[model samples]
Target: NTVPIYEGYAIPHAIQRIPLAGKDITEYLRGLLKERGYNFTTPAEIEIVRDIKERLCYVVHQNFDAVLKESVENTSIEKTYDLPDQRSIVVGNERFRCPEILFQPKHAGLEIEGVHKYAYDSIMKCDVDIRKDLFSNIILAGGTTLFEGIGERMWYEIHQLASSNNKIKVLAPPERKYSVWLGGSILAALSTF
Candidate 1:
């Protein structure tokens, strides 16, 4: 229990409580072992486990605090009247939009930046010509990509990330979010892939 929690388990509170409250089956089993002449486990092992678990919990909390501080300090959304209509707003940029941050730890959040890099990497694994064509026709087909300016943002970022010579474009179907579902229905109706 301590080992698992110390290794940055997501819900350490629930984990810690289960053993102390006698609500965890695994904890009960461990206690049963101790009662059954398994006195081989010394006090030193218990102390060691406790120390490691506390250290892990501290590390995760500290990192979370740092990321929160960085986000607060760097990203601020302003709704000032910067446009003719007096309704323009500016949303600050943060590490969250940087897809590379997903695979690599940024500030403190768990690495899983976004899908772009994953998709790009997957495409790169294909045959050279296929990969080239894939890159040429890269499309973000998902419901979450429906944010108002997401298409343009993705186009700019991905173009910057990819080779300067390779043309990068983000194609949005009419009703972009539902395009995949509509395409699936069309394909199924036509008995096509």
Candidate 2:
């Protein structure tokens, strides 16, 4: 909401990168399709499933388990996508469940933690005096952040980790898919980066 007076990461140790990303979500969606009796056996078929993830998968704002149950009882969250073969797949809880791995990698059989934890830990690694500032200025950029509701989910999860008195804000820009490129472009334009 306020103008940026300064933008820099003073504590390198506070920087973090989660092992998960968009490709993982795509693959997980493919697996979910298989579980639902749609066998995507070829690499080309995998691309179709990737398209399904792009169009259908989304992060849930509520508890993953709760939304899954609600989806079953509500049916509105479900989507049906047409395949190249003239057939179609009914995307149900898999819509949210596939992206759930970003928050709960165990679903993908990975012991790693969620993306929010990386941000929380990064803030905690910094000087206590600036932790609040970091939380209020969190930036979510990359192809993975393109999932609908993903930014909101990150805010919710990070808020759960901080004190109630603290505020959490996440910025997901419109061109976040090229965030790195944009940042580099800005730096390149600068005489001294």
Candidate 3:
């Protein structure tokens, strides 16, 4: 969920939560593995899937349809990931398709709005005077946001949703995965009380 902070306080505006998250992408990739004739019902297997997703999955900004079609043909876009058993699995479309859920949740059977819509909606719910500030200070902090191209894709999508005159700036720090913890530590260090 995207929270708008104003005047050093988080404003209780649009607090939207969706079923779409990092786990959803992992689950989607797991399903793909199953379709490829790989049986994985054990927790250990699930961990392997999660590891593969974290290590290899990435977002694609363009040619999504081409990637999907080419993936089926086992094109050059495919990557081989060696499992602990010395067997390797070919990964292709799953790389971008899984992350595509962030932009189009319906692709993963989720009925909720995409991240771009959520962010725009949240800013719209805020006062018009602060909408620009909200757009300028957009901070993306989460494990899911760490995927390569996620920040770029988000900026492109949100920019499309926002007015042309409104400057949209999304901040995705390198250490975004631990942003909440780091933020708390900073607050604690700066607190006089």
Give the whole-model CA lDDT for all candidates, comma-separated: 0.39, 0.82, 0.83
lDDT of 3 by residue, 50-138 (tens): 88899888888766777687778776767788899999888777777878888888787888888889888988998999999988888
List runs of model 2 lying over 4 Å from the truth.
Answer: 1-6
Backbone clash total for model 3 is: 0
Task: Give the clashing residue pairs of candidate 1, or none.
Answer: 102-112, 102-113
Per residue, candidate 1 scores C-alpha lDDT tens digits across 31-117 of 333443332145564443233222211111123346545656664521122323354323222212222232232322433433445
- Alpha carbon deviation, residue 68, candidate 1 (Å): 13
Predicted structure with the largest TM-score when compared to the true one: 3
Q: Against the hidden reference, what TM-scores do the models get? A: 0.44, 0.91, 0.92
In order, how many clashes per candidate?
2, 0, 0
Instruction: Give the clashing pairs for model 2.
Output: none
Scored against the true structure, residue 7 in model 2 reaches a CA lDDT of 53
